[model samples]
Target: MSTPLDIASLIDRERIRPFQWTIFLLCFATTLFDGFDTQAIAYTGPAIVAAFNLAPGDLAPILIAGTLGMTIGAMTLGLVGDRVGRRPALLGGVALFSIASLATAFASGTSQILVLRFIAGLGMGGCTPVLLALAAEYGPARHRGAIMTGVLLGLPAGAMLGGLLAARMMPVIGWEGVFVIGGAAPLALLVLLWFALPESLHFLVTRAGNDQHAVRHVLARIVTWPLADDARFAVHEAAARASVAALFREGNARNTVAIWAVYFFNWIAWFMFLSWLPTVLKASGLPAAQAPLGTVVVNAVFIVCAIPLSIALPRISTRRLLIALLALGIAIAIGLAYAETSWGLVFTLAGAAGLGIGGQQIALNYLVVGAYPTTLRATATGWAIGMGRVGAIAGSAVGGTFLNMGGPGGFYLTLAVPLAAALLAVIAIRTNEPEAGTSLATAAH
Candidate 1:
């Protein structure tokens, strides 16, 4: 009998190669565009409101529409990724969002803008979980956390890009022009992804086993040596198809519940801040032109801290790290309540919150990846984040209401409550000691 080809071992033992970097960069690009389109509405909210003669509260429907689409997409499209393949699902998401963004430029009224944002959000929500799954599968077990963390950096990077682009282009191209640029750039990158990006090797060797040649081809690209023609490959999962319900089975119930709770609480607070911070800054006497810089500062520090923190996560206890970060987040929220008195203090709190809460956000994502078998990794991630989108929708809706109430202090204070709840959820979660080598193949069993 031929020895079974253990792909998990191959990736774990082999030296990191250029192909892995290529995969990481491609996923990074997908996330970058996802972030850009998601935040485009926020960055251009003032302009969109001015153009339509609307109040800040009116923007809530548009924000909630996109997040609602995200909720739907994360569950449905995420199931598509698990049932079909990550590459196609990812591409489909990119196409949907790109087209919706282009359509947003021509929206004539609130309803039209709301519909287009909902469509774009479907794609945005679907892309992120698939990207995280792919990054975990492609990266060496030792470095998977860092690679996925790096991939997620694209989110804040895209936000930073949106802020800078809006500041520069709103003058020349108008808000519609910003959407046009965001739409156009991603469409171009979509072409690059079609040609250059490979499907997840783990998915191929495991999920698409009927196509043996394709599996060998992808393996050859990542493996340092050539594969033998007769080499047999196998993933340890049972023959039954993976499904969302599987996440609740197989000793995963507690983990699934905890993961969803964390995502929901964290995103609720995070999106509320993300969606309205610029307007709040503007209300606090920052120049219309400069209000976005507060968000820019927050995103910059988030990306910077996220990169190094993810690299260090493999060496530390993720739960402890998360608790510490959430505590810091609470402290920052308190400071933010008092920050309206000074732009200097506001900027300082924003940057510090980015470092604390931002790192916790990324760490929670990494924890989710490790909590499930590979067969259901994408499904579990999608559902966790999908449910979290509900919280995000609530955040956007509530932020609008809070803004209407006319006090920045209350908005900041409300956000702290969710952060504290999420911290407690982390403290309550229990799991088998995390596997040191969390490869897709090993994770599947």
Candidate 2:
């Protein structure tokens, strides 16, 4: 008789195959568009302000609405993936956001923009944790850090692309044209996703009364050879019922809280940079035309730093690495406080901030994904991201205040406190590495 299959072990032990890479690519594409939708408002802020006859502070509600919507989606739709399956939840999110993006172009007033952005936020926010979970689940345990980090890179990549595109297009087509492009590309992608993306085999195996044959079929694509029809599959998790409450059960409460605290604090500073950087750069004496350069420089450097940092993560201690990144961020923020009109110095400091703050947030995602069992993975990621959205909202709102009150120097100085708090949170969380000598098969059981 053929040996029964342990699904988690089979995945963990196997080298990554084409199909798994395909899934990662699909998830990456989703996130790329997500980044575009999320940051497009910031890119168009000046145009919007001029069109609407508003002050810099007026944009705060628009910025906060998107993230607040994200908070709700992360908390709610994140669970939908677990209840139904990742494929459907992801597809739904993509469609929702794409449609909302198109509608945002036609927005007539602040009320319409706020409502539409919230709607778009629901889709974009919901997709992130699901994609993160999919990437983590499909990736081999040995290289999970690299795989998930690779997916995380999609966000910055999209941001940089949007920056470039917005720069080129805004001169000709105006800000509304940017939204049209953002909305349309993903809608075209949706068809590809419908055909190309496969459901997570790990999720299938974990489902109660799951179709073992279906799991076997998906596995056949992942493994080198066909499985016998009679082979059994299993995902090892304690039989505690799966629910949101389970996130707080069995000592998970501490881990969940730590993850939330890290995301919340880190995002406060990060979004402050994203939502306000261009305006601040302009105020700091960079030419009005060149302000967008600052935003692009930060995103470009972030993309460059994230790849190497992710690759090195498997070799170094995650907690220590994150703490170091946060410390570097604090130091960079101080430098930025003093940076003046020399565009060269401003760009350099922005890049450093990217390396410090942006890199730490990516590493934090890796930690959150690794902290939970398969059952609660999506929910845990969503909740942590949700809590972070609260910070993002605060950052967006406070950004206006910073610009109005202290200017760039005061704003940069304020970032240090949050970075320090996030560092402390990283120190407080325990690393949940696989126990020594515990093989994938043994650990799953």
Candidate 3:
């Protein structure tokens, strides 16, 4: 029951004096744009269909390809980030995605477009985990929760931008113009990230030796404490010492597996709702015009939850927060099945589901990363992300199959099976103190 973890002192935001707020803001903006460009295609789907003369079912491959690409990028660049540092990983991922967007503008066929999208996805995937690591490493300790909020809030904002641009820009430049802008804009910012964003001080102290000039500069600016000793740390060597097998080395393996399991189900439930809800709403008596608006409302609710979740997370036990959100998600799925009316009950359930989804996502990420030590942070995050993507793909792909068979009610009710699994999984994540030698891959804890 007694753990030496100085979490309270470690996380003091007032003491987070080294990293500049401006730098954190920059990282947040970069991720926001990444989310926007990635989702822009979904907004342009109607136009892309008209231009390419494609069918509803025909676009699935493109979506799948992109998702798969992102999955690979997350795994690959995640390891690369640990070895080479987050800055290069961030820059490379952004550059790759930007070029893919440009290539999409000249897509000559469905196959070409699909390939381009997949490449773009690889970039997007690479950006997220590293950006998260970057944010965690560079931001003030106490402000990590709020900083995550500022960084991730860019997503909904980006989605809104995509929606606005699709409404405005597509008319003038067409879908091709949209892709051109998506590709070109990030490429432009690539120059700015290179010059303005300094490597994380924690990262530099660990990997680059005691470069007092850089370390002292960043430390004095970012952290509130003025320690007389300036010791350089090596994150890569520490990371190299961590093996996949180490995740289970302590009794903590079970907890690690528990986190993965909950994430697995949460992702499935969320993506399933995203891909099928609008279509199901239309089928269940709502007008086609109003169906997609369900997504907008859900997203709006998600945006509202972002700040509250941040405010709540560090104040609560991570495992407890994870389980509560998962339970809420399960209840929302069932509630959605019964709220069949134009009275907006369905929209309310959708919004609540959005809240659960957003909360669970943030909690899961924080829990997984914080649960692990510095060396294996990205790998732990990568596996959790990779597992979640499997659910996302299943949700998006299989929801279509469900809709073809029954309707919205059956379509949503079926997803409750996965939510149930997620609930059970999170319930298994017990509160325990962190162990120094615990590997994150095990499930015994």
Candidate with maximal TM-score: 1
- Local distance difference test scores for all models: 0.81, 0.80, 0.69
Off by over 4 Å in 2: 1-4, 203-209, 238-262, 287-289, 314-323, 365-386, 420-445
Q: Which stretches of candidate 1 lie over 4 Å from their true place?
A: 202-209, 238-261, 365-386, 423-445
lDDT of each residue in 390-439, candidate 3, tens digit only? 98777666765675665667776777788789888877766553443332
Write down the TM-score for model 1: 0.86
Residue 151's lDDT in candidate 2: 86
Write model 1 residue lDDT over 360-398, tens digit each, in one string. Answer: 766775566567656676567657766677888898888
Question: What is the lDDT for 166 in model 1?
Answer: 81
Q: How far does residue 232 in candidate 1 sit from its true spot (Å)? A: 4.1
> What ordering of candidates by lDDT runs from best to worst?
1, 2, 3
Error of 1 at 272 (Å): 0.4
Candidate 2 lDDT by residue in tens digits, 1-445: 6666777678887899998888899999999999888888888877787789887778889989998888788777768998888889999999999999999899999889889999999999899978887887777877766676678778888888887877767877787998998899999999999998877676687653577877877888788766766788877665554677888898888887887889999999999988888777767876545666666788899988878766665455677888899999999888889876766777898888888878876566557545777667656665776788788889988888877788878888888888999988888887665333322222222
